[model samples]
Target: MPSMHRKRNKSLGLLELIAIALGGMIGGGIFSVLGISVSMVGVFTPIAFVLGGLLALLAAYSYVKLALYYRDEGATYSFYKKTFPKSRLVASIVGWWVTFGYISTLALYAYTFASYAISGFEFANSEIARKAVAGLIIFIFTLINVWSVKGMGKIEDLMVYTKLIILVIISFVLINNSNTTIPKILHNHEDINILSIVIVASLTFVAYEGFQLVINAVKEMENPRKNIPRAIYSSIFITTLVYAIISIGAILAIPFENIIQNQEYALASGAGEVLGNIGAELVIIGALLATSSAISGTLFGSSRLISVIANDGYFPKFLTKRKNNIPVYSIITMAILTFCLILSGNLVVILEFGSVTFLLVSLLMAYTNFKIRKHTHSSLIVTLLSAIGLMSGTVAILYFEAITKVEQVYYIGGLYIILTIFAFIFSYKRN
Candidate 1:
């Protein structure tokens, strides 16, 4: 991975890089988070999405600066280690935090994939059925990724582009067929406040996370200084538009009660009542494609990160071994943990856990970028604001969890405690 220029006969261009970012970001984004956002913010859902996008762009600014300076595919973990070389414990902790964050997202995508894939079935709401389907999808993607990296890339290209079109059409069709206007929605939900909307925005941070996957391709792309910013910024901008449009359409067309009731498959259930079967079918297809590609891309990218960490001796050495250039142990280990997360929590719990994990991790990245702003050519104000925004987002999530479901926060806190213990032991052994 060191000789990045010698990656392939043809390095990734801006278009392919954008496709990867969009694929990663869009996959588990709208389809998974929309219902929850709507539930929390009512007619203000699009506003939350816009706020979330702004936060994403802020986080991206720091990521791009660090990426241009480092140019390593190890990405978040690698950047942190290089920035604070002597702080082995913090670096080891960051590696663990980021890797587990990916696992939670993999679980999020698979959970959404199952919800939409079986939305039309008799057992759609069955907990057992949902988990079984989620696990099955994970199994299928795991096999595809390990069998051939080239094959996985091609499938990714197809799904990424096709899902975008489907999602656009679904959003337009929903808005065109809306039963109520935004004004009426506003009149009914007049009590909603800015703080609530911002909380939802913070909780929805997980949806914008895949943009970092672009930096993970540093070794596969050209001109890191140029392409990293271009690809990540462009993808997030485009995705923000996509999400805001979808949020507008969803709130306009889908009844809040129905969306809240069917939270997991909100679009599927509501699209059916609003536009009949044709619209529902469109949403299901788009969601399946979105989540499928997301699961594949995440598993592929995160496994490589695991391989890097294990090679650094933070994890079991066997995870660094590969067969046919595939990190088989790392990939399988991630999938199993993803299923475990799904089994342990419901949709909201998983979503909150993932949202909090990524925000904290990105916050750490922002702090690291600020610590060496001169070397990264980063501005003082932008880096400070980025850290502040990420910190606020993390605090907002904890506040939301504490307000709505206090026990959920304890569960998430316990999980972090376990991860911290693992990170400590790993870093201690290295000493």
Candidate 2:
């Protein structure tokens, strides 16, 4: 049985939860993945985004069900504990891996913002200037998080609202200016198959991973059981619609070939091409806001994970200590790790490895759902569905890893397994 010793300050409202979800989901992936997605699926890139959203919705449903039943602070960790008491060590490993993945994602978004800001300036050709700007941005945000999570949350709420308004405006503009016939969706496509769609869609689906972070906020939610589900589903629905319209407009504004060539900021470039310099600037600002909001939210959530782990006796008890009713040490630890990762300048590799770790954790979560159904005699239908959804998503990610030849996936997977073994060995000896 998992014990909840510390009570959380449940001050987050539905808007805050929604802001976190939106902030996490709409990070740099939206700006960065457009070219790659276009390359993979052609004009059907928008369709791939919608498909990713549906799959994410499925995962969210599973999480909602588990949250309602378990109501534990550990999120996935607690779910696994209820289902596999003896496998507590494995659950802890999964939880840590998940936290690490989100941290890597934060690094990726920070790097993306640096890349965009550098490219926007006349002195962008100066390598030293570029690095300095990137480092300064990371440092500023790290300080923001270390100083106060609640303060960061307030900033994120404002940032998220601004980004949402921008997306809505962009979508409205696209719909109003759509001169191309809708038939081009099918008529322009030359080839479409399961393999191609999944290959292309996986990139866009990465954006949808933001929904997972909402579960971390459950402890802070006033009424998690009801609010979490509503927020998750509603955010997904709105983001999906926005992504589809923006993607299609981007493709129509710029030729598919041109979009593929500008791999970095395809959406912004397309916006610039169609809507001119002002539109491009708006999108760029949106990108910055999106990335900053993501970093803030991840810092908040990952600190909670650290606090949970410490409370479980995995680390020094100091990590569990709270100041002003907040886990100060845990938050600082997360900021330090993120700062170190920013220095590596290997943000892309970190993201791929992070995705691999996350996939493994998701797989474990699904398995836990399945095991819970078998052991506790609870409703099996949703659990089974959740397991299937997680498995499908995981398999897709693995396939993506292999196809992309990201060798880091194998190394990360092997290292995590080794760590899991060692953690258990130490636990056994200590006990």
Candidate 3:
């Protein structure tokens, strides 16, 4: 057992790095967002997924540049802090926002895991039962991570690759069983709003949020410069393809009403109806593995960043507590807060907040890269475009929420206010 600052042997290869990145990106993301996307864009759901991937790719440009330049495992916060070393406030704000962003995603993944786990039970729709299950899973993974680093990595590889295979199989099965065609769905939705498609695409960016997890693995990777870009770009491209095919199969095989009706367990319910019980079971297994791995990977990376922030005095010193080379306090704190969010049972609002936070942080990253383009070997044009694209995504999601879910807008706004206050308080204390 080693302490927090002890350097372990770097054993992860390129494949394992890809597994971690994919595991982080795919968890509960597609399962959670598919229904919302279809509800907004109708037959154009797959198109929105593609557009969302493009936005993610644009954001990755800045992140990869920063990762190569700094090569620090602190990720988003470290990039900002190193780029603007004099601005402790900038570092504190980025750290808080990025940490909470990961927390929201963790909560989202756990809640979705619970949704699928209990989908077949008589009390499947019981909110209380769902929250209880969510808490149980988070606690389970927290223990796994705090127990052993090697075990977590091995389990992540197994779960990530296995779930991907299941997802691909499910997509094909649904497509084979379909009674409808793409053209027919398109013709039926000919009157759908184009703006609606763009808005859904912006919101769908949340599903592509985990690619940055690769940069967080810099300390454990073989080659930071090469593997970082290879893993991220490949993961995003593969994720986009998988999501597109799944959305296509889903819409053609099942009705949109069922998807929206069973939003939490959309694929499971849809598969049950079209391909019988085994199809449904396969989907359940895939969702479970996807989210389980996501929970583990997110906890692993996020706890490290938390430790880094705490070391800088932007967070409570107690958060730097470690056991057996793991950040025990940070991991436990994230799990508890995530469980509380699960108790809130407002997955929709949580999803929106997660999206807004990532988009804003990404914009900041792009701006930081733009400011120091010469050193990072980044392009001014591409970095500027990344910022513009991310800015539009933030505005699009907020505007869409205002028009459709005004209450959610207030909820997101209030969360930002609380986070901002904590950031400044800790930052001032550090000074």
Candidate 4:
């Protein structure tokens, strides 16, 4: 409620809150996902993003309501735990799944950061170099987070705002130099159907995953009642708009083959081919800023969630320890796990895992809101719609992975089994 600019404040204002949410949402999201989306539905990429954003917005409805009622910085896990205090097993399971989902997203962001950060170098293609940069950036942001919340917020504000300006410039330049018209592209891809677009949109749920990070900062921000909904909704709307414009520009200007071939760094590579070095470098810069701030915001918020869950006996107790109220152990532990994920998995798997994890976790959150609809003052119709939409998104994603990458479906099932075992053990101990 108070201005953070009044000489070093303890609380985050609306601007810093929006910066954190936007930072997480935009970072590595569009940059890494563009090519895959284009490959799936061609010129319908922006339409998919818009539809995916609607899913995100629908999910945000419950998040905002629960955040205000519970007012807990713990967010997803806390909401479920509080809503179903008697079901320790369910609560513990949700805790593990949601927490690890954030970890995977953090890994995805860090890995994306490394890819673009070294794109111009000869060693950029070297696996070792990319992993090293990923680890290094995670370490750097970990230090920033452990140092101070205010410091991290300030740095996030800079990166987020600067990237927005650069994205606008990139969008304008790309559209101005367009090589194809929307109608013409659509004619060529007339076979693409609504089911494919919806599936593609579900594939994009990962990009919209970070809006809930705003609720993670509830304890540090002022006026949760007002800022909570404002920050989350505003960030989602803005991020969707930015992603649409950028996707439109890329689809119209860059060749589809180029985008598909250069999947890892499509925007940067395509921009380079179109506008030469300057355009490419601009995209690389935007990618760097996006992932950097995303890494910062994800680590900052997820650590707090971890600490809270640890205190509730679902995680390692050591994670609950904090240095100067910063959850240093949780932050460092998450960074280490994230780096391990980066080392273990390739880019595509990491991205899909993050998206799938978030989709499942958000569905649970929507279910939580539906359970407490009356108490949270939520509309029955909206709650049902949110749950239905999230369920459809989840089924859509799993269907895609099942049909295309059946092995990944097994891999995801294996992960859930392992997580459920841990959740069971933790719940048993708590009982």
- What candidate 4 gets wrong by more than 4 Å, as runs, is 1-10
State every prediction's TM-score relative to the real structure.
Answer: 0.96, 0.86, 0.97, 0.97
Full-model lDDT, candidate 2: 0.68
lDDT of 2 by residue, 52-118 (tens): 7876776666566677777765676667756776775675666566666776777667766665676
Q: Per-residue lDDT of 241-328 in model 1, one digit per residue for the tens?
A: 9999998999998889999899898999999999899889999999999999899888887888898899998999999999976789
- Better candidate number, 2 or 4, judged by lDDT: 4
Candidate 1 regions off by >4 Å?
1-11
lDDT of 4 at 150: 82
Residue pairs in collision within model 4: none
Question: Candidate 4, residues 1-431: lDDT per residue as tens digits?
Answer: 24533333345899999999999899957987998999999999999999999999999999999999998989999999899889899989988888888888888888888888888888877889989999999999999999998889999999999999999999999999999999999999999999999998888888888888998888788777888899999999999999999999999999999999878788998999999999999999999999999999999899999999999998989999988678999999999989988888877787777788888878888889988888999998988888899889889988888889988887777878998999999999999
> After aligning candidate 3 to the native by TM-score, how far in Å is the CA of 131 from where it should be?
0.7
Please report, in order, the local distance difference test score of every candidate based on alpha carbons: 0.88, 0.68, 0.88, 0.89
Better of 2 and 3 by TM-score: 3
Per-residue CA lDDT of model 3 for 364-423, tens digit only, reads: 999999989999999888998899999999998888888888988877888778888999
After superposing candidate 3 on the true structure, give the runs of residues whose Cα lies further than 4 Å from its correct spot.
1-9
Best by lDDT: 4
Q: Total clashes, candidate 3? A: 0
